[model samples]
Target chain A: EAGVTQFPSHSVIEKGQTVTLRCDPISGHDNLYWYRRVMGKEIKFLLHFVKESKQDESGMPNNRFLAERTGGTYSTLKVQPAELEDSGVYFCASSQPGRGSPLHFGNGTRLTVT
Target chain B: GESVGLHLPTLSVQEGDNSIINCAYSNSASDYFIWYKQESGKGPQFIIDIRSNMDKRQGQRVTVLLNKTVKHLSLQIAATQPGDSAVYFCAEKGISSASKIIFGSGTRLSIRP
Candidate 1:
């Protein structure tokens, strides 16, 4: 089976611009998660989606960032008026709906804002 | 805020020797712990996992030891090889946090010839 796949392995944007990252989870997976890791920092959770509904979004940093999983298949994260601090690697993962289930992650999209 | 952390930022081990990486977590409520290995230009891959009900779990050449008393976790690799050189991360998940997993700063393992 194919693993989780992320689009645009690398992205570069200017400050105040808008950028969007996409993630396609493994087939038949219902739980999708988004995570970000800044340079030299630990990977932090961003949000989670169970099917088309969001399960947890408390990890979202600010209002400028938005995430959606339409049709319950793929997810997209958008950052409007992006700031330098928004630059980081965004990872997407998926797993079966079970407690302690192992997560399968994508290669991640590296975003650089200048 | 509760967080997970590694004791060392990096480790160097000679080939054919065993390697141990240590991690400390602050959330005593965490019931599940896992370890991941990440190579350059790739996402993290699951190595091993241990639940609070068990003290140790082994898979192939890797072993994960968890001590709930001290909120400590460690990963031991036997017969370390060049391919084993990568960044290892320890993560934890608590029942209260639902399915969210907390990750720690990774420890880079370097194998010397």
Candidate 2:
């Protein structure tokens, strides 16, 4: 089976610009999650998706960030008016949460905001 | 509490020798834990995981130990090889959420051939 894959491996955007990161999870996986790691910081969860619906978004940083998983196949995370602090590695992970299976991660999109 | 930490930011070992990396977590309520190894420019790959119910769990040449009483976790690699070099991070799953895992700052492991 193919592992999770993230798009653009790296992205650079000027301040106040909008950027979209894409994640394709493993086939047949029921749960998809978004996490990020800022420079020198531990990885933190942003949100989760079960199918095409948002499960828990409490970890979302701010209102400018939005995520969509239409058709429950892949996921897209969009950041509008990106700030310098938004620069970090955004990771996409998937898991078979039904039986407590561990999550599998993708290479991640390294976003740089100037 | 509930913060995961590593004993050292980096570790160096000789190839063919056993490698041990230590981690300390602060969450007593954290019952599920995992150890992930991330190579340069790659995502974290799962090595092994242990629950609070078990003190140790083993995988292909890798072992994970969890001590709930001390809030500690560790990963041991037998016959460590040059390919073992990477950043190792221990994560404690969020008991408050539905299997949300929080990662540590990570420890970079270097192997001398």
Worst 10 residues of 1 chain B by lDDT: B93-102
**Tens digits of per-residue lDDT for model 1 on B11-87?**
99999999999999999888889999988878889999999999999999999999989989999999999999999
RMSD of each: 1.1, 1.5
Clashing pairs in 1: none
Q: What lDDT does candidate 1 reach at residue A74?
A: 96
Candidate 2 local lDDT, B53-88, one digit each (tens): 899999999988887788889999999998999999
lDDT of 1 by residue, A1-114 (tens): 999999989999999999999999999999999999899588899998989999999899999999999999999999998999999999999988887887889999999999
Judged by DockQ cut-offs, the docking class of candidate 1 is medium
> How many clashes show up per model?
0, 2
Misplaced by over 4 Å in model 1 are none
Q: Give the runs in model 2 whose Cα sits over 4 Å from its true position.
A: B94-97
